[model samples]
Target: MAAKRLREAEESGEPGRRAGGGLLPFGLVDVDGPSMVPTLYHGDRVVVRYGARVRPGAVLLVRHPMRQDLLVVKRATELRSKGWWLLSDNQFLGNDSRDFGPVPPELVLGRVLARVRPSVSWLAPAGRLERLLCGWPLGRVPGLAARFGLSRRLSPLR
Candidate 1:
């Protein structure tokens, strides 16, 4: 079967990634805002691990208390008295902990390990790429959610 071959390739440690395999030994997350800007983007893919240590500059995905279903990614700024005070890399962006207040460490799902950007070796110039590198907003999560649809929609049938 196709899956059998993919599993074999993974076991072989081939440079060619197998289907459903990741570049790192962690879950891959899609960046959703300009919070991490040049370091991360709206569409860039990032790897994260559940037990990764939290650091000042590390970007993280955390659950919103009021809306537990909604997950937001932001830079870990300071460990404030209340909780972790997260901030967006783009100072102009206002939809972060600075607006919502400190977030509990329990809310954090994982820490970003690395980022992967879209390759454009054979394509034309992209202004978005420039903005991404300049610490400005360039990617979003809505498009990713729409492209993949809700988790419920993607669930396999019995």
Candidate 2:
């Protein structure tokens, strides 16, 4: 399967190359938890761009430093001596850099461009509002949320 090949490539320290002799510059990753809350949610499918420039505030798909087989999505918080400090937008979620420390650059798989699945129409506006309020300063700025209507619908990628 593609996931198996990706894991193998990662473990081997090669860039996550696709099977069939072509480089995979992009990948689709499923969101599994509320760590990203307002920005992402359970079952949300994200488009991850491999080898993209990672910046503070950009969401990333990274291999767990201690458990490389596990991949997680988190926002890049800061550049640390080891690599990048990644944190969950939902502070209540404890399995981020706060617990595991900075993730080495090599473990970072890709930058999350946008959520693509579950379709925009399926996301309830009220649910988006609730998540925005719950996440507060980290998830959504109150003023921005009020003005923009708290929709997680991302623009289509060109």
Candidate 3:
């Protein structure tokens, strides 16, 4: 339902954006790290629908549970007894549930709908192929991957 509302606002080209004082159904957030590599890269701008439905495999914008001042983009990998178990697609570089345990649903700010930077297009949400590719040996590269445009994960967002 929340996703539908956001799509409606996007289709209507609504002007009541949260940035404009009136709250739109969705907002834009810039991706800042490689935690969601392949699916989301540094500098990518994403459409986030607040209160959108979060299910396993949804890309999410969340407040870092241990550092509320920090916002991180992660994927909902499982629903635990306590809360959502989040994971980073970039297995080699994650600071996720493995490190912080399950995250309270309250920290989930929104669901990522699409990538609007470098290009404007809807995402193939829950892309298993992309997720699989992220864990390849290349994913461990803190030095190599981003330098060669390993995937759409490292490209011009400007």
| Residue runs of model 3 more than 4 Å from their true location after superposition | 1-22, 124-158
lDDT of 2 by residue, 35-146 (tens): 8776677877766778787765567888888877777888777787889887776667678887888889998877776667776421112444545554857464545542
TM-score of 3: 0.65
lDDT, model 2: 0.63
TM-scores of the candidates in the order shown: 0.56, 0.66, 0.65
Question: Best-fitting candidate, measured by lDDT?
Answer: 3
Candidate 1, position 35, lDDT = 59
lDDT of 1 by residue, 52-110 (tens): 67755556667664566566667676676777777665667676775788788887766
Overall lDDT per candidate, in order of appearance: 0.52, 0.63, 0.65
Query: Over the stretch 1-158, how does candidate 3's per-residue lDDT look in tens digits?
Result: 01223333435655655421237657777777677777777878878877788876667777788887567778777787878888777768758888888889887878777788888755434445445445677556564433322233321111
Error of 2 at 58 (Å): 0.5
When sorted by lDDT, best at the front, the candidate numbers are: 3, 2, 1
Q: Deviation in angstroms for 143 in model 1?
A: 30
Error of 1 at 27 (Å): 0.3
Indicate the residue-level lDDT of 11 in model 2. Answer: 55
Sort by TM-score, best first: what order? 2, 3, 1
Model 2: residues with Cα > 4 Å off, grouped in runs: 1-16, 19-22, 120-158
